[model samples]
Target: MGKKKTKTSSTETSRTVTTPTRPDWVDAQAKGLNDALTDLGRADPAASVAPLSDLERRASETAGGLGVGGGWGSGWGSGGTDWANWGRATPATGPAPAATAPDLSGARLEGRGEVPQAASVLDNLSAYMTPFRDQVLAAAMGDYDAEAGRRRAAQDLEMAGQGAFGGSGAALTRSLTEGELARGRNSRLAGLLDQMFAQGASLSAGDADRRQQASTAAAQLGQAREIEQAQLTQARDIERARLAHEGGLEAARLAQAAEAGRMQDALARAQLGQEGELARQRLGLDGAASRRADAETQARIGAQVRAAEQARLSASEQALARRIEMFSGLPLGLFQGSVTDSQGQRNGTETTSGATLGEIAQLVNSLTGSPLSRLFQKKGQA
Candidate 1:
């Protein structure tokens, strides 16, 4: 058989096989260090520092975002949050429509195109006087004929008497005288006829003129009646036109009043709606304010808690570092034993353990008090 090969290995390792009995002093020191380490773990400095950086970054982002918004200084409000705008009244309805214009076409009046013509009064009067003038002329002619016949008979009788009484010279002279007398009588009768004819003609003309004047008056009366009738007709037409115009105006007024009333009603309703909306908006703003206040208070409380945790962590870390420094000076490897390797028939083992009184005292002092405290006030001091 080949020579048996032998290999050996030794390593330092901590293993718990069973619960160990510890001295009172050692237990106290161990408990102090464990408590300090546990506190350090619970209040890690990173917990405070990391959150602070995150908070600062978030605040910066919020402020920057607000600044970049378009409103600028004019848009700022009480808090960082944006404020709501006030409710506005509903836009006014378009202007009230114009009232319907009155229809006055029928109410307007127009004058007649042609004036009325009346018959000629002078022409009518002349026709009426003509018959009376002719009757007067005939009566004058008949009287002249009767006077001429009587004058001729008287002259004949005088001429016969002169002839019977005269055969001598004296009788001839008397005959000549009688002839002269007859001529004179004839001339006188002709003159009398002429005078009668002239008187008749003058009377006839006077009668004709008087009759013509009466006829003219009658015609004037008829024309006056026609004028009165025309005036009455015109008055009636004017009155009708006035009544129609008044009716149209009244209708327009009624329409205007109705439109005004409608507009007022609409305005009232709109105002009422606006008031209700404003109330709702105000209530919302108040609720937002309450929520904001609660959030700010919570933030302050959280910040205080974090600050306390950071302080505790700093104290705990310092205590843990002091404990490490104190234990490093102890000489636990001074108690030593050898290790053996087992090949076929041999087994190997190694062990080490030790403690120094000075190390124990240093640890005890570190736990109960500081090194400076032990040096300055050791046993008694005045």
Candidate 2:
């Protein structure tokens, strides 16, 4: 008898894994965002302000000099002081000087001179007018007297020539002619006298009107002078009041500007401190997030490795079980057979039989027609 040999085999499987990568566009976008954040984090430069002009500088200096009691008045009426007197002028300790009337000596002199001249003109008017009237009357009467004398001479000659000068008719005509001539002379004298009187009255009335105009003009000139003086005094007072008010306003503006500057400085400091604290917090959060991401990645990788190892172990175990079952089903023992004698006679004859290797191979091939059997066949051939 010979011992049968048993064969053991094993198979190894290898797995391929592909790791995914980020696209080019995704990487570009992430780079751009990072650049933008960097730019935003940078500090800004300080801005510059324009210099003040000459007028502004002078105004500022003037305002600064107007401190408490420096000018205008004592302080701007702070605590316990009367607000009504903030920009008021100081009252006089004694009574103010009384306003005096404007000087009118020149006007008075002129008026005096005019009055005498008007009086003199009035006094001489009648003297000059009387002579002029006499001359006019003499000239007018001379022409009439010459014509009357010529007519009288002609009448005498005609009467004498006609020898009627000494007669009754001639005497009567002569008497009537003399009487008519006398009446004409009287009428002309009366008219000349009336015209002279009328002219004198008109001259006196004109002189009176001139005198009245001069007096009225003198009075109006004095009144205008007084009004001008009053206006000048009022203007000076108004100017003083305006200056005081402007000084007070300037002082108040300076105070308000100082307060505003202090508040702005405090606000800027607070903002800077807040920004620094926020930056620190952001750094801490970024670090924490990075650590958490790393931890998660490690956990995922470890789980994947563990799963792969378990699958490999299970496959190896299943292959080993199938090999064990196939080996158990094979008949490896030898068999012996004995032939019985006819008629139950005792005979000493026996037959022995056993399964060969080739028969065992055929039986195993028929029982397992799977890929595992082909794998074994290929290995055996190799």
Model 2 has an lDDT value of 0.51
The reply for model 2, stretches above 4 Å from the true place, is 1-128, 222-382
Model 1 TM-score (2 dp): 0.25
Model 1 poorest ten-residue lDDT run? 90-99
Q: What tens digits encode model 2's per-residue C-alpha lDDT throughout 79-179?
A: 34343432232321111121222222222212221222233346546864786577987888888799889989999999999999899999899899989
In angstroms, the error of model 2 at 149 is: 1.3
Best by lDDT: 2
Worst 10-residue lDDT window for candidate 2 reads: 91-100
- Report the Cα lDDT for residue 155, model 1: 48
User: Please, what's the RMSD in Å of model 2?
Assistant: 61.0
lDDT of 1 by residue, 1-382 (tens): 2244456565554443433444466657767777877876777456535144222333344334432323312223334423232323221222212222223233222442233333343434444445544664456545655665675456456756766433465467566656765676566656655655556556656666766677677666666666766776666566556645653554465345445544543454445444554543444444344334333433443354345345544543565687778865654344233354433344555444455677766766676667765664565373
Q: lDDT of model 1 at residue 184?
A: 62
Root-mean-square deviation per candidate: 70.2, 61.0
